[model samples]
Target chain A: MRVNGAEVEAAVDPRTSLLDLLRETLGLSGTKKGCDQGACGACTVLADGERILSCLALAVQYAGREITTVEGLAGPDGPHPLQRAFIDHDGFQCGYCTPGHLCSAVGMAAEAARGVPSYVTADLTADRVVLDRDEIRERMSGNLCRCGAHNGIVAAIAATYAAGPGERA
Target chain B: MNPFGYARAADAADAVRLGSAPRAAYLGGGTNLVDLMRRNVVAPATLVDVTGLSSAIEERPDGGLLIGAAARNTAVAEHRAVRARYPLLARAILAGGSAQIRNMATVAGNILQRTRCPYFYDVAGSRCNRRHPGQGCDAIDGHNRDHAILGGSPACVATHPSDMCVALAAADAVVHLRGARGARVLPLTELHRLPGDHPEIETELEAGELITAVELPPLPPGAASGYRKVRDRAGYAFALVSVAAVLRVERGVITAVRLALGGVAPKPWRARTAEQALLGAPADPATFRAAARTELAAAVPLRHNAFKIELAERTVTAVLADLAGEAR
Candidate 1:
């Protein structure tokens, strides 16, 4: 299996989640596990560039699949734009849920840009979903930040809206 | 988790053969099964992985979707044929656990996911008829808010928590099952059995049988579909009162209608009476309201779940209204 573009093989329990495999087995703790039950956004990661709850993913299912953790969010630079924006907007107080929030925000913004309709999207079949406060709140409803930094997180996401696909405006 | 031997099945036949043993359990994505194993709800001696099954999403010549049982919820929802034909199913799958869970959770697994009753999860010497047959039902008189209002026996009232099953029932889908004895197709609505004499026997699935596929019939022309669910929270929560509606209206009259209610029944509650009422009536608010009222007429709510009947009625009416607008 590929973790951050590197192939690694280690003995994993059949019940081990991808989050545990990355953090415990592979020694990559960048992916935080706030709620192991998939309630919080702390265990969010990208599988083949699509955002998913890592805490709910089984490690055995990701054979030869690409997994991008928070450690891979940087590109030899100091940080990704979402990460930088989180800093600029003071997106974290305790910073426990920041990684999952950042990953989910990136995926949500990409989905919105690609015209994926969500629950709050007025038209279910609409091509484009406008990202207002309500849309942000509804689309990111699966990811919760207990630190009360949602306002800042929303600001950071709004800032990256126009930049499009991995770019921060 | 207890250590268990693992074997990946080559196909459906192999899966059934391996699962024939009482100690072996078929494993799909391991989303729910793994969680249950960690919680010690289920402890199988052997795990048979079925991820190697074919991923083909075949469209029947009669205009139906032949979804492989192993098909991930995400793939089944995003398939072009499914999206264009059965939008209700796609919508229901999208409104489940999470993106990751959907990616791993198979259609068969979703249908077979265990009950979410709080007492069922409390395996620490708790009494649950579904868990331990004949032990007794502790939920009948205690914390019955999420309990079923329909098709519930005195033994158990645990609600089946699959959003897709509700839509499947409304869409008149068929479940293809393969076992050591051979293959058979059961109507999706009849797949789940009422908790009658035996609450332990939840579904009609025979021993060693594996769900191979779910077959969805073609939608009628001008058929509009909708899924509406009210839960404790907005996203990622089980349905409190969910309604799946597929209605066809012609000249302001409901030509045909299929209604199924979730979270209000032990199985998917097919609103046959309500559908019959709307068959030749106007697809307006008044008719939909009357039909919704007729469906909840037989609801026997518990002390704490009296609100579910009214909530389900409103949900049914609201979905009917939304679907009627789509038909026009």
Candidate 2:
């Protein structure tokens, strides 16, 4: 599979998960394994730009896909825009769940840009992007912050993305 | 997880051919199966990756929708056709798992996923008949506030946990299946079986029979639909009681309606009795309440889950009333 923009190859056990392949074999530990079961969002990673839980994903099943982990968020210039906003907004305390939250928020921005509707969205007929506080909280419901830094995290996400029209200032 | 061989099927025929081997299983996105495998609930010898198969969500010529089995929950929920015509389906999918899980879970996996009964997952401590037939069910008498209140046998009271299937059932969808015996179709409402003496036999599909697609039939004229779920939290939790309804009313009277429930029965329950009760009744809260009562008249609740009886009634009533209001 392609890891972070580079093509890499490795032989793996049939039961090896994508998370294990990245952490154990490929030496990318930025993607933390919290629950290993799908309950926790700590294993969130992007495959072909869509967020998925690497712990439940078998490595062999995603042989030809492009995977982006927390490490891929930065460019040659510096940290991604969302990363800078996260630091400015104090998005973490102990900093354990920040990686998953950041990755999930990145993917969520793409989803919002493409007009994915959450349960809280008032209209479901057409493509609509309203990245308000409620929408952000609903979209980021999967990624939990145990350190109770959600207000700042939501603020970081809101400040990073342009809140669509009709959003509160 | 246990070691297993994996192969990606080229198509339906290839999947059936590769899956004909004993102990071979079809792997969708593996949100639930992988978790179960980690818990040692299921171990298959070979896994046929059918994600390469049909994942198309095509518009049928008859104004219905044909969703391929491999279509991700996110795709189907976000499809323009589903949002415009089948809002119940789109809403149900959104009301389901978190964004990551919905992105990974497939249409077929959602239908075939197991129950969330605590006893069934407690492989190391609790005895569950669904896990091991004849082992006796601990939920029947133990702490089972979430167990099924209807259509459960003494052997098992586990409730099927798919929100999408309930909407499909309400829409009168049909499931397409393929196996060594060729292809066949069954109503979505009849696909899952009620837990009888054999709670382990959750589905009617024969060994190696793979679900290829689900076809949602066209709704009646002027029918308006919606899905409502009541859970423990505002988001990201299994439903304690959910109602999906498609209703048509004319001149303040019910003309046509279809109802299905989740988190209450062993399968996605087709609320036919409730529909019959509301067929000609006035479109009002009283009519909805009467129909809900008729539907739950046969429900037998467990000790800790008696509250489900009232919750299901109120939810069904509220959902139908909302849909009826939309129609009028």
Candidate 3:
């Protein structure tokens, strides 16, 4: 599998999940394992630019796919805009779910840019999806922060979204 | 998880051949299967990965949709054609699970997903007839707050936990299946079976039969549809009760209506009696309430789930009311 712009292969058990392969084998501990189930989004990652739970994904099933984890968000110059925004907005407290929140926010921004509507999107007939506060909360509902940092996370995501596509990284 | 050999099928025929093994399962997104495997509820010796077989969602010549079985829930929900033509389907798909899960879950697997009864998931001590036939069901008497109140037998009371399937049921979609025997088409309503004497058997598909695609017919003109789900929370939670309704009214009279319910039965419950009650009647709240009551009268709730009866009625009434407003 090609992960984070690098080709890496590991001989793992067929039952091993992608999250385990990233953490235990590749030693990428940024992705935390909270529930080990798909209920929690701590293991969220980008598979072909779509956000998915790595905990429920089998490693062998992602053979030829390109995966982007939390560690892949930064550029050579500095941290990604989402990372900087999170820090600026105090988007985390315990920090266990920060990686998931950051990665999910990236995918959520792309989805919104593509005009995907959320549950709270009032007008289905509208061509453009406006990212208001309720839209941000509904779009980022997958990731859960135990420390009650939802307000900060929402603020960070809104700031990053306002930064535009050219200033993302 | 238990050790299992994995094989990625090259095609539908290859998947059928490989899935015919003694203890083999067709793997889709691995959301439900992996969770069940971790809980020791099911242990397959071989897993035939069919995710690569097909993922196309094309518009049919008849102005309908032909969705490949492997199409992910997120892709199906976000498709422009689906959102424009079948808004209820998109809404129902979005109402389920979460963004990450929808990104991974496939349409076929979502239809075939198992129930979420506490006893069925409690593989350690609870005795579930669906998991272990003739072992007796613990949910029938034990904690059954989420159990079924309709179409439930004495042996099992588990409810099918799928929001997408409920919409498909309301839309009258067709399920296409392929196997070593041959290919066949079945209506979405007949895809899943109720817990009769044989609670173990869930779907109508034979062993090794693979769901290839789901074909949805074109919606009638001037039809307005909607889906309403009342869950434990606002998002990322299973529905305690859900309603999917389609209504076409002309001159303040109901011309046609289709209603399906979730979280109330072993399969997606089609409110046929409710549809009949509303057909030709005035599109009013009184008719909707009467139809909802008529459909929910057969509910036989357990000690804890009796509230679902009222909830289902209210949800159905509310969805119909919204559709009526749209018609006006």
Candidate 4:
């Protein structure tokens, strides 16, 4: 499987979760394991550019798939746009959940771009999704911010993609 | 979590062959199974990965839908046909776990998910009949606000946790299964068994049976359908009481009504009695309330869950009233 932009290989026990393989084996500690169970989205990562919980994900199930973590959400220029937006919007206090928030936000942005209808998305037949504050909160509900920095997080996300072009279904 | 052997099956045939391991279980997106594994609720020695099978969502020429069991929950909810024709299904699927779990969970896996009852998950502290047969059920006299009020037994009262199953029950969805006995189909309503003396045997599937697909019936004209879930939190929380319904009214009369409930029963409680009471009745709140009360007459609630009986009636009446208004 590819991690970030590089091809990576590791021999892992079948019990190894993608979170364990990343934090314990591959040395990518940016993805925090807040809850080994699936309740907390602190271990969120992008599999094939879609958000998924790494703690519940079997490392073997994701073999040969591309995984992107917070560590890889940058260009040669520096921190990714969302990362910078998080800073500008003060999207963190203790910063424990920021990494998961970053990756989840990126995946959520793409989902909105794809016009994926959320539970709160009123019009199921609508061609475009409006990424308003309601949309951001509902889409990112999986990732919990314990520090109560969700207001800032929502601000950052809104500033980034709420007004951006959404996808037509 | 115990160490387990893993093998991916290319198709349903291969899946059955691989599932022959004595303690083997089919693995989809590990949203629920993994958590259960970590909690020691189930410790399978072998896991047969079945995601390699068909994940197609086919909009049949008959205006119905056939969803492959391996299709992701997100995929099923976001499909154009599902959103347009079967909005109840789409809404129910979306009402479930957050986007990440939906992206990881499969159609069949959602049907087979275990209850999220705290006592059931507390392997070390609580005695669950499903977890350990003959060991008493603590939920009967324990903090059982989250337990079942309908179709419960002295042995168990755990509610089925999938919001999507409630919609399928109301929609008359058919589940296609392949097993050692060849192939068969079961109505989505009949797929799950009540926790009557054998909560361990949750589903009607024989050993090594694989759910291949789920077939949805076409919606009737003049139908207004939706799923309404009441939960503790606004998001990411399991339903406290959910109502999935489809209503077709003509001249202020209830021509057709399908209703099912969640978070109140061992299985998706299809309110067939309520539908029978509702048919040909006025599409007014008075008739709706009466029908809901009639359906819930058999509700036997636990100590902490007695409120659910009244809540269920109110939810049903409200949902029907909302749909009746929409159908107008």
Q: A-chain TM-score per prediction?
A: 0.91, 0.94, 0.95, 0.96
User: How close is chain B to the truth by TM-score, in each candidate?
Assistant: 0.97, 0.99, 0.99, 0.99
Q: What would the per-residue lDDT of candidate 1 be over residues A12-70, giving only the tens digit for each residue?
A: 77778889998888899888988686667688888887777877777877777888888
Ordered list by DockQ, greatest first = 4, 2, 3, 1
**For candidate 4, lDDT tens digit of each residue in B1-328?**
9989999998899999888769999999999999999889999999999998999998888888999999999999989999998889999999999899999999999999999888888988989998898898999999999989899999999999999999999999999999977989999999999988899999999989999999998988879999999999999999889999999999999998999999999999999999999999999999999999999999998999999988999999999999999998
Q: What stretches of model 2 exceed 4 Å from their correct place?
A: A164-169
Q: What is the C-alpha lDDT of each candidate?
A: 0.82, 0.91, 0.90, 0.92
lDDT of 2 at B52: 83
lDDT of 2 by residue, B184-270 (tens): 999998899999999999999999999999999888879999999899988888999999999999999999999999999999999
Better of 1 and 4 by lDDT: 4
Model 2, docking class: medium
List, residue by residue over B212-282, the lDDT tens digit for candidate 3: 99999987778998888899878888889999989999999999899999999999999999999999999
* DockQ of each model vs. true complex: 0.43, 0.80, 0.76, 0.86
Reference contacts recovered by each candidate, as fractions? 0.25, 0.74, 0.68, 0.78
Model 3 chain A is weakest, by summed lDDT over 10 consecutive residues, at A160-169
Residue B241, model 1: Cα distance from true site in angstroms: 0.4
Write the number of the candidate with greater DockQ, choosing between 1 and 3.
Answer: 3
lDDT of 1: 0.82
| Candidate 4 CA-lDDT value | 0.92
Chain B in candidate 3 has what TM-score? Answer: 0.99
- Considering only chain B, what TM-score does candidate 1 achieve? 0.97
TM-score of 1: 0.94
